[model samples]
Target: MPRPEDSVWAVSVAQVASRPGQSKPIDTVFPAPAGIGDSVVGVREGADIRVVGSFDSIVDGLVFTGRFEAPVTAECTRCLKPIDPDWTVPVTAFFPYDSGACRDDRRTGHGKDDVEIVAGEDESEDVYPLSPDGAFADMESLLRDTLVEALPLQPLCREDCLGLCPQCGADLNEDPDHHHDVTDIRFAALEQLKAQLEAEQTGR
Candidate 1:
């Protein structure tokens, strides 16, 4: 039985470049930021993170792909109230092979999406820690960054979700009389006319 705080995983960070098909879990919550070039942004995630990823070498950095799961007790986007959503996110990222890119991409005003930050002197380091142990294995930052990437730009429960009824404040799904089906009165009158015509022809 490993205590939450005492849990630390051993990874083969340096060998990712040479040996393929390697992966590990960086389990912990920390702080960090997101972005690389001109557009960079802040990053954050749950207190604890569970990262399951496979890392291989790339020209720029270690290419990693996997899923991260954590207890996300955040407010519902609709209600703006607390709603626990066990958010499990799948991710794909490139851990800068060299920290040089992280340092080079430290300029501001490159546009929000134009730049990214791996590790810089600015911002909370806890939010975006290292990735690999010897190579900057900040599982915390990785989880947060991947989460930001995975988040839906326009999140919704459904495409056509009729949210809580504005009138009686009821969930449309729960309320039977929420959206009533209406028949046209003109059509009903025409049916009666047709019936009368048929009755006259039958002389009944």
Candidate 2:
């Protein structure tokens, strides 16, 4: 295991392939970097993300299957009220120890540079990378990407949130019955004509 301060989410995988039948159980927590919140709406910077699961040896490399949970803090999309929510994200990733094998395999059509995969690309590029010597696997990048993708485009406090009053910018959830008496612009001519007739009839 890497030091919590230096490589908070990196796990050593040097012995996994040798122990084929064993699966390394993983349970760790790390303070997410402050930059993580810039891409996500509800996530707080420096929040704790708890990862729990295991890495099992496959044929060539290893598979990291885990789940993570973190606190999400953001305003409700409908009412703009501050809210605290929790997100549980499931992660299933494969990191090959020797990416060169894939490059040589005719079926994979991957090149030598395929080992250094980019984020948010096709499934072909989704594989995490192991160190050249296969000593450790860094999970910080993968976890941050997963957490960002897990956020909803518009987070809501509740399914039945009443939202806010458009006219006064008041939270409608607090006063569900509140409303504005706005007349339709199409009826403005009719309303003005009725007012004029009433004024003439009253000799005003």
Q: lDDT per residue, candidate 1, 11-88, as tens digits?
A: 446655433355544443333322311112112321455666566554345556677775543433343334344577
**lDDT, candidate 2, 50-133, per-residue tens:** 989898876556778889888887677898877777789998887776665655542554443433332222254347787667
In candidate 1, position 60 carries an lDDT of: 40
How high a TM-score does candidate 1 get?
Answer: 0.45
Superposed Cα deviation of residue 171, candidate 2 (Å)? 1.6
What's the true lDDT of residue 40 in model 1? 22
* Cα TM-score per model: 0.45, 0.81
